[model samples]
Target chain A: MIGIIAMRDLRSLFAQPLAWVVLAVVQGLVAWFFFSGVGRFERLQPQLSRMSDPPGITDITVIPTLDSAAIVLLMIVPILAMRLIAEERRAETIRLMYSAPVSMSEIALGKFFGLAGFLLIVVALTAVMPLSLLLGTSLDLGRLAAGLIGLTLLLAAFGSAGLFFSTLTRSPIVAGVATFGLLLFLWVINFGGVDLGPLQPAIDYLSMLDHYNAFLEGTIGTEHAIYFALVTLGFLTLSVQRLDAHRLQT
Target chain B: MEERSTLIEADGLQRFFGPTQAVQDFSFQLERGEILGFLGVNGAGKTTTMEMLTGNLAPSGGRIELNGCDLLDNPRPAKASVGYLPETLPLYTTMTVDAYLRFCARLNRVPKADLDEAVATAMRRCGLEDVAERVIANLSRGYKQRVGLAQAIVHDPEVLILDEPTKGLDPIQVREIRQLIRELGKSHSVILSSHVLPEVEAICTRVQIIHEGRLVLAEDVSALRARMQHSSLLLGGRALPAPESVQGIQGVERVERLDDGRLRVFHDTQSDTAEQIVARAASEGWGLWELTPERKSLEQVFVDLTGASESEVQDTNEEMAA
Candidate 1:
């Protein structure tokens, strides 16, 4: 069933002009960040290398600079995920989905994975960031691998969050706004001093930013990885329920 | 001698929206190889009924059974045998006609090995061969309608639910779609909803008329026609005797002239004795035209039986959707 849905999404994306535009814009941004990060790292290395670093240059320049890839992913995710469910509902294609033999779970997972596939390209385009480090500073394979793992999980969460918001409205613009707004709210909510102190422990575990920090330090924390996975699964599960209920109600 | 093939049996189905009742106490049954025309005026709960039966919208009360499988209890299994073509067609505008049907085929769980063959057959059957590669957005309205038909039948389900299948077609297109429905009726149990009474009469075997969210009548199309009090007359060739003179006949109650120049003479007594007038016309050399009994159009039958033609929610919805 998931294969059927993926096949449908893949064909739809390939055929739509809007999908092509989204793909091109995401790839352009990722490419721009890759070269710009490498250029900035090159210019900074000469001044910083002379001073004794707290950690090796691999930790200082490579891991930290490559973290820009995650930022690039953040910008690309909501755009790709915005159209997944919103457009389906707007176009009445959700009716077709509801009437199909496939379950709501299969539909959600297929769309999640399909959006992830497009987002993966944005993630993959940032390969130049790590490869550039290899050409100059010696690469830290462990940290880079850890960072990649973390980025994949983060992508899932972002995609799932976008998917859930997409379900909330029929307009892609609304889905995009809601997704980015939710993420921003999550980021800013922790800043309140009263809420931060009391909720800091739970906040850290729930925070996507903190979960991603583990990979930047060349560490693989199963707990952190699970946190991102849980967020992804949580939002996606909510999305499935929302859609199923909506289907049953109307 | 034959299988008791009950494709769909819906009973006491109702849908409410906030303060207003959309569909109330709706019920009907469709048997295999039976083409059932579902009739209602705008907002008479036609789409709502289709939605409930096809598993898109849940019923607020009552039950829908497909081949005896409870729709509310297990919608997927019940839906597996049903194909719904919504009034709007539910097409994916970005995909080509063929591609969309192939996608629908997969979604409907058609076997992988026969997917291509099945898609091809559905497209061909729906008269969508020439525009297979064109994006649905680019197709003409008539072609778009055919594509809707293709998608609905792509998986070859046993029960086909079509809502206003010919809502926006010219006369020729309507005729063509009617022919297609007749062909599909040979194998599938079809429940087609339309506001046009004549369309129901043209192709359907049984009809269920809903008025004000309730079942008005569910009977064979011919039976409904028979129940209508007034019988129509079919006159042909040159015109006949004067209206007053025809009305002056012994059994003649009223005589009205047709737009076609033929006279429609109504009678209450000696129904078979209209031939006496024909004989009189012939003997007097009064240039007798053709005289034949008029079959009431389905619209007249519905107007008579339902007694709520313009007021049904489903019928009103049929208009709004149009």
Candidate 2:
């Protein structure tokens, strides 16, 4: 059932122009970031060769481009996920999901996987820009792989949270705004006042930036993986619960 | 323990939103090969009751059994046996008719091997084969309605629930949809809710009138007509007998003359007074152009059963007609 619904959602997503527009804009921005980083690295390479320890192209051009792709995805993914459930509810097609033999969990997870699949395609298209630098430079393949993993997990987390808010309302605009607000809050919560003693670590743990920063440096720690995994599961479960409650509350 | 032949049995179904009692004590039993028409005024909780039966809304208190399976306790099998077309047709406007039906078929757990055949059959049944490749958003309202019905029955459920299936349709489209529904009723137990009394009288085998969130009356259509059998004859002609002369006939209860050169003769309910009136008129050479027995329309029965006054019923019926 999840596979079936996921395929349907993906099909519907492509049927509309929003997905194509978002893809075009994100790729344009990613390509721009990649070329600028390459130009900066080219200028800095002559001076850095005299130093004892010189940063390679991966550290200067590829990592920053990957990081920029993550930032671009964070802003655009809510738009992709907004229509997953909210548009269905608004258009009254959500009743088909409610009355079908499939469970609420399957519906929620199907939508989550569907948007995640689209985001993965976007991530892969963006990765081609960084991977193309291998023609003239020795790129750190391991770090690039880690960053891709981290970005995909983060996209899944964002997709799940966006889906939760979508289930909460019938307006896709409201769902998009609410999801963007939640993701922004999670991203900036750790940058509050520096005087907190006990809550500092907890706030840092909740922040998405801290976990994603570790993958940018090629460190694949279980802690960050667990953080993304737990957050994804939490939002997915809440979405399922919200869907079940919708049947009851309506 | 009883061998239940009832396809759908909803008892004491109640749904309340905050302090408003949307529906209460609504109960009905739908058997196989039955086309039950649920009639109610707007905001009379007809849609709420249907949402409960279709598992879109949970009742505050009720027990619904579908084909011997408890709806609440065992929703999967119960839901699998039912197909629902909501008031606003649930459709993905971007999808083609064939794709949407296939999606609905898979969602309802139709096996992979049977998916194509199921979609084809549903399209053929709903007369949607001609525009199977058209995007749903581009289709006309009638075709959209047919697509809705096709998606609902793609899984071949045993029970089908339609909420105002023919609402907002033109005369010809309404006839087409009603014909499709009647054909579907032959194989599946159908529960249709509508505000149009004539449509109900035309298609439904049984009529269930609901008012103020309660089941006011439930009976076979023929039985309901029989209950309102007020042996009245409408005699129309240029030179009809006087009202008093018609009243003098045996078994005649009362007589009144209409403005349009017609005599309405009320007679004993147990007698064939209409036959006698026709014979008497024929023998008297009163220019009997027409002698038709008047069965109280479902509209009159609906108004009387709903406990609304004649004027209020007229207002709503006029609204419905417009």
Give the DockQ-based CAPRI class for model 1.
Answer: medium
Off by over 4 Å in 1: A52-57, A192-197, B1-4, B228-250, B254-265, B283-303, B306-322
List candidate 2 stretches off by more than 4 Å.
Answer: B1-4, B240-242, B279-285
B1-322 per-residue lDDT for model 2 (tens digits)? 4645699999899998878899998888999899999987887799999999989998999899888888888988888989999999999999999999999999999999999999999999999999999999999999999999998899999899999999888999999999999999998989999887778888999998888898899888888767777668888876786788888788998888887778888887877787787788788888778887787755577677776888887877766676
Best by TM-score: 2
DockQ of each: 0.64, 0.74
Q: Candidate 2's C-alpha lDDT?
A: 0.88
Local error of candidate 1 at A121, Å?
A: 2.2
Per-chain TM-score of chain B, candidate 1? Answer: 0.84
